[model samples]
Target: MVSTSTTGVLVLLGAPLGNPEDASPRLRTELARADVIAAEDTRRLRRLLSELEVVPGAVITSYFEANEAGKTTALLERLHDGKRVAIITDGGMPSVSDPGFRLVKAAVDAGIPITCAPGASAVTTALALSGMPCDRFCFEGFAPRKDGERRRLFTELAEEKRTMVFFESPRRVTDTLRAMAAVFGDDRPAALCRELTKTHEEVRRGGLAALAEGAEADPPRGEITLVVSGWTGPAASEATPEAMAAAVAALEATGTDRKIAMKTVALRFGVSRRDVYEAVLKAD
Candidate 1:
């Protein structure tokens, strides 16, 4: 250990989200000087250090979600003993959606000096490429995995005017997007950013329904970021049954499955599923 900690310090370093080169100089310096590296995944951090080619003199320790409640006090004890500990998650900034929040809260309550290494984030990456406004946006992280909770999340954000960013897994992308389309709308402009900053990086921009259907047919692998456009107030025809049917048809026009379309129409217009289904059938 370099003993850079005559005064204890905790630095939350942002690991590279995808491309290894995304590591920042500040991150390198922090990792180099940290007496203890509290990382979510020790092996991933090791690979990152190898990629950066910076051999740290610090002791590496694991600090992920599973053991955070137990490790918070121990890590705080190290800090209290005047050790400089650096925390890093697998990717993106720690404490954002990762395991560093509890530790950060503990340190702050104890009057510990805490700082961060700003680097690549899927939130910002997807937002910039999403062709959506970023000047004022909110990162919702990952929505709940369960359908009911996820639906409530979408409902809460249904009226959010600021551009929204979300992290989703591969297998659940379609389901999540379907829920988003339901609460937000089939015509709500959105983008699906996959494998950002990697070899097979792709950005598919369209309505939520379009991306959901496409991704369902060909499920995207690796990380998925959904940058959905802000609420636009009922898509011009929210007042009539015929208009709702037309909107559903438009969503279907973009290759969204009928079931997904029904979900969207039913939720967005605050109508029953049976009503939306009958309307779509009448349209046919």
Candidate 2:
């Protein structure tokens, strides 16, 4: 067992998504000075350390999805014993669709100090590279693997106004895009980002239908992140007359002519132009 006199602090370091040069100076210090380092993949951690040219002075242990629950106790014990416990994942932030969540929660419950060295995040990286509106967005993590569950989830988010970000396997990328086109409308704008931060990185942008067709022709490989534009159609349910009118106004503000905007919004809400005209008067 490694021994140290340093006060225990649970440090979560954001490991490089792809490039080793992305490792921060603080990450190197923590790795070298830690009493115990919990890594999602010990082999990858070793490789990263070798690449970064930093030999850790800490004992290393594997802590991944399968062993995270089991390793929590040992890590917490080390922390409680006043040993600095540093957590690093294969890539990106810990506990973000990665391991280290249980350890962090345990540390917090035990009143142990918790800190982080923020680094590369595939979610943010993909969003920035997607060329989509990033002002308001939500990360959906990985989609449900099963077709039924995935479809249901997509259906639920059909009216979501915030841009949606999702992580999907390369094998399922084409299928997921096709399914999204079915539920979210074929013309909804979207971007498919694959192999981010790597030499073969590719970002394909277009409407959902077009993207689906492109993915069919050229299958994507490596890590994938998908960004789908939010719903801008007429409010579906519980939409007040005023709300429907406001929706039309919003469309018109986007350089769409008012008559066309009203007609489009009316069709979206499954209502007639006369109904939308009445709602507009009410809004006024």
**Cα-based TM-score, every candidate:** 0.84, 0.80
lDDT of 1 by residue, 1-284 (tens): 57554559888888888788777888888889999999999998899899888999999989998999999999999999999999999888889888999999999999889888788888888888999888889889898988767865776687688999988899899988887776677668999999889889999999988888998898999988889887655543464778778767755654556776677667567677888888878877
TM-score of 1: 0.84
Off by over 4 Å in 2: 1-7, 235-284
lDDT of 2 at 166: 95
Model 2, 117: alpha-carbon shift in Å? 0.4
Q: Where does the lowest 10-residue lDDT sum fall in candidate 2?
A: 248-257
lDDT of 1: 0.84
Residue range 82-201, candidate 2, lDDT tens digits: 999999998899999899889988988888889999999999898888787899999999988876677667767877888999988889988788777756656789999887777888
> How much does candidate 2 score in TM-score?
0.80
